[model samples]
Target: MSHQPLIDGFEFATAGARQKGRWPVRELPRLRDMLASDAGEIAYELEGTRDERGRPGLRLSLQGTLELRCQRCLEPMPFEVGADEVLVLAASQAEIDAEPADAHAPDRVLAGKEMPVRDLIEDQLILELPYAPRHEGCAAGAGQRADERISPFAGLRGLMRGKH
Candidate 1:
């Protein structure tokens, strides 16, 4: 596949441009680390605009399915990744640092001459991934079935119950 194109953040926002494309899952480093199988596609849409507060910003949307290992079952679990983010553009690192980190505020990023689109999309996917993914209604016995599991404290339990 051809390399994804980069954008000039400042120029894009000034031109009010929009872009949409798909990125191979294997290409994203951080997202790849969490995947059980890095064989999928991440669809992304980006629009450069001015926010309600008149701040130059980029709106990003990403959607994809990732095969992640279920923390409980240790099996492949399909996880749907969806994220929408608005990043306020800062001209320099100093400007970004000056902004207070508020939970309710849109994220701020330093605008660069060349912004790697894939990197931005990958960051959003990483943020949306679950810390410990688990399948809904996973196969029975997948996680420590009673019949197969041996309790570490079984001997102590028997002693405490006067059953020894």
Candidate 2:
């Protein structure tokens, strides 16, 4: 019933432990309520691995789908983002530095004892959001019509003809 089950099997015993797995995630309207936005039913699968370090550090591959509004057309746009995310769940900077630096160096350091998958998913979505969202044909159609209506640089063409 709870979406948290997506991360149920993830092991947090060590920082370097591999957690390659998959989970079905459904984003209900309630989830978007927290973001102060209304959205439709979003269903997607999150597939990735969490490379844990010694104790509690994790490097996660954040990949999933997010159904959101297109900035230009105001239509539903489903975005699939695959992000290589690293989260260092260490108490302090010293603890993070103590870990071996590899391909999974965390972009952010967590100053806590536990790593919550929900929180991580929220952060990843925020980071993956585009500044502007538009449907594939939204801009192309308008541009083509504008081009047909008026000649681009029509006055310049006249000037060049006169000079010749």
Candidate 3:
């Protein structure tokens, strides 16, 4: 999967402006198949400018719908994901690390002097993924049922009881 170009050899100043546009998911590697299968669009708003050290920094806001499988039910689930991410584009990893810890971490490096929107989008999606993905209203019954099925005296409890 190749990265699609978003910002081409452009450096922003302190008073830089925000860039707003809709990027096709097909252009992004991770999102290509997901977007196609789910049949939806991913929209983004990029706000950034070049820092004093010449690093490109931006805050990206992404909102879109994705067709994904529910981790628990294994059924197709359509989820609307909204994420706000801050990224710093650095010429090298060392430069990125040199930045203050308080500053936002760089999701990617623009070493070659180009910022690919597709790459950024892929990163934002990954960062936005929930640690435990589940459909709404699907856990209350399932969790209680599992707990009920487990015997409180199934294993170690029997051994301890015998010793007593």
State each model's CA lDDT, in order: 0.73, 0.45, 0.54
Question: What is the lDDT, from 0 to 100, of the residue 160 in candidate 1?
Answer: 23
Order of candidates by TM-score, top first? Answer: 1, 3, 2
* lDDT score of residue 122 within candidate 3: 72
TM-score of each: 0.79, 0.50, 0.63
What is candidate 1's lDDT per residue for 15-133, written digit by digit as tens? 87899888899998877888899998988888888888998888898888999987677899888878887877888766655655444667776687888897678766766666666
Give the Cα error of residue 50 in candidate 3, in Å. Answer: 6.2
lDDT of 3 by residue, 1-164 (tens): 12235564235313354666666655566655443254656888776655445666666789987766655776666767898754545555565445454313334344345656666667666545543445665653265233333344333321221221
Cα RMSD (Å) between model 3 and the true structure? 13.8
Which stretches of candidate 1 lie above 4 Å from their native place? 1-4, 140-164
Better of 1 and 3 by TM-score: 1
Error of model 3, residue 100, in angstroms: 8.4
How far in Å is the alpha carbon of 1 misplaced in model 2? 20
Candidate 2 at residue 125, lDDT? 54
Comparing candidate 1 with candidate 2, which one achieves the higher lDDT?
A: 1
